[model samples]
Target: MKKPIYRTKDEELAQIFSSKVLPRLRRLEFFGIIMAAIVLLVVILGVLALTVFRFKVPDIKLRAVTIDNYSNLSGTLTRFNLTLREEIVLKNQNFGEFKYDKSEAILSYGGKTIGEEEISSGCIELTYTKLVVVLIEPKFEGLGSNQNLGGGTNSGILTFNSYIKLSGKVNLMMISIKKRTREMNCTLKISLVRQAIQDYYCH
Candidate 1:
């Protein structure tokens, strides 16, 4: 060439901007986008953990069982009647609220249903305990010569069993996320002398 070319400062700066600054800026933008996507994924996983993956069935227990009434404790016991009262305790240890439907508590003897009662529908708050009362009236029949009855009455003790089941849904974030069922079975021994429940076991 005849002479050396001259470049302006502005041109030099423009060339630097296009070659270095622009690519660096694009890389920063891409990094920001990836970071944003990761954050969004974490939030979604947290929400699922609290509302769906951590769900569990409510805990149910029989707090107490007692005999409210009986017919003629001291007699031939050809035919007898019994009235029982039960205290059911519901414990909720979840982050969501539980709302159950109407259900039943049944009383049985010798694999036979002798009495039953209705339990009203209700709700249990998170980490709270609820108490429900149920009444059962059992009618004894055809026990004139049954060995269990004859032996129990003569020995001054009577045995019975009770069952309860509850079905409901867990409510969280204004949505019913899961459905659960809980149940309890108990065997009780009644002392004729005390005219009350003496011992019991439940599962």
Candidate 2:
């Protein structure tokens, strides 16, 4: 039989490191580093997308308000009647179209509901503004003792506070995403003699 060859300690150690330990450590380092970089990149992109390219809510405002008709009892002005017309505009400043559901415009006086009108469902194109008109007719039985009436004078001037509420949703690409609502309080001055709105301010 041939003589058996025995390896020295240093040679055995080198062989073990090259064949087993070195390969395992290399594999771990390569995969671990690549995975960490991938995770970091994903997080950065997610944050940028949420903050910089996020969707924005549309702007709604009352463009114009008018009193179409007004009538009251001749001398005492006890019974009050009036028709109000409002023009609302919705401005969409996003990159996608803004679709809204059917909504209502509610009118209130002295914390009491007076009238309500329906706002039709529609969509506003990207970077566009849409106008919606609403008409409300409210009848008052006895305004003679209402403390909320401001300018009750002999010249037939009357003042009151009115509230309007608008509620709807926003849709993107035919998918519902967010809900939107707005409330406006307005002070109105009316002239019973001329059947017109004298002054108004809304907030």
Candidate 3:
């Protein structure tokens, strides 16, 4: 009969580890390292893609302005009230459409808010221009009773400023990108007597 081989507990454990458990542990570690490298590469590519396809802010300009009506009495203008109509053009210079949320157009004079109009949510196509019209009713008060109409008293020229605040997200090929805000400030000069816009500038 063949004699049975007797091995120490330490030797058995070391042989088992070398043949079975060690190989499995090395394979698992290698797999983990490969997976981490792949994940890192994916993240780096995503960042690069986002940087290349980033959205740009649109341009806002005051295209035209008109004073519909003006009322004056006693040969000296008091309560200079009129309807101010402004046309704002938004030009999109981006590669994707700009989706904007509800915004406001405010008209102010002498640090006082005189008029406000709501600009509803809308979208501007890529490389397109959108025209938005806003109507403002402003009543000029505290004009001295002796103020002659258009008599070199500032030439009956009133200066007013407008602000447009818009906030929205950008969409790139059905993928939603980051959110941004656009602010437009404009200065306007109007002739109360002629009821016309003299000069306009926006930034």
Candidate 4:
């Protein structure tokens, strides 16, 4: 006859711990590692999204145009000169500063250039609007018999067109990047009787 082997209570308890509790603890540790990895990935994606959005290209727009002053509407239409002072609002909607070079605004009547004004170079801060004023002195010449001028003078109104372009770069995080251009074309009408702008729009 063979006798069965016997174990102590402490040994049985140790065996149960190794077989059951050890495996459960290992599974918990693996799940914790996976959860931590997922959380870290989510955080990295979030930071990338924020960085891309913050440093994206800027949007520049011409918000408004106004005729501040006009002169020399009291003489013969073909022999008179008109000096125009116009105000334009340059709006920058971005998280960076825009630095533009010196540019000029051109005035045209009857498809011919008549006057020009120089715009000084400057910087526009993030999410702000800059007001720029330019003065153009238009000389009436070479269009002695244009029917449009005659009609406009008879109706006490004058129509003109203006164009401006600003080329610049965006400064983000103290570094300049991304060359951009902003342009505006405006058609305006001035009432001779009121010496004021009748209508104006820019594109």
Best by lDDT: 1
Candidate 4's error at 113, in angstroms?
0.9
Work out the TM-score per prediction. 0.77, 0.61, 0.66, 0.69
TM-score attained by model 2:
0.61
- Runs of candidate 4 with Cα error greater than 4 angstroms are 1-78, 142-148
Ranking by TM-score: 1, 4, 3, 2
Model 3 global lDDT (CA atoms, 0 to 1): 0.78
lDDT of 2: 0.72
Candidate number that wins on TM-score, 2 or 4: 4
Clashing pairs in 3: none
Residue-level lDDT of model 4, residues 86-177, one tens digit each, is 76777766668888889999999878887888999998898777888788877666565433476887787888999988888778778887
lDDT of each: 0.83, 0.72, 0.78, 0.75
**What TM-score does structure 4 among the candidates reach?**
0.69
Candidate 2 vs 3: which has more lDDT: 3
- Of the pair 3 and 4, which is ahead by TM-score? 4
Deviation (Å) of 193 in candidate 1: 1.9
Off by over 4 Å in 1: 1-19, 29-33, 36-40, 43-53, 71-80, 142-150
lDDT of 3 by residue, 1-203 (tens): 99999899998989878876898988999999999999999999898677646667777888888888666654544445678899988877666788889988998876667788899999988778899999988644433332433343356777888899877777778776867777999888887677788888888
Q: Give the per-residue lDDT of model 1 (tens digit) for 1-203.
A: 58977889998889778876889988999999999999999999999788656988989888888888677644654345668999999987678898999999988877877778999999999878999999898766533343446578777687888998999998887689889999999998987766789999999
Candidate order by lDDT, highest to lowest? 1, 3, 4, 2
lDDT, candidate 2, 5-58, per-residue tens:
899999888987887689998899999999999999999999867853466767
lDDT of 1 at 110: 73
Q: Which regions in candidate 2 have their CA more than 4 angstroms from the true location?
A: 1-52, 72-76, 142-155
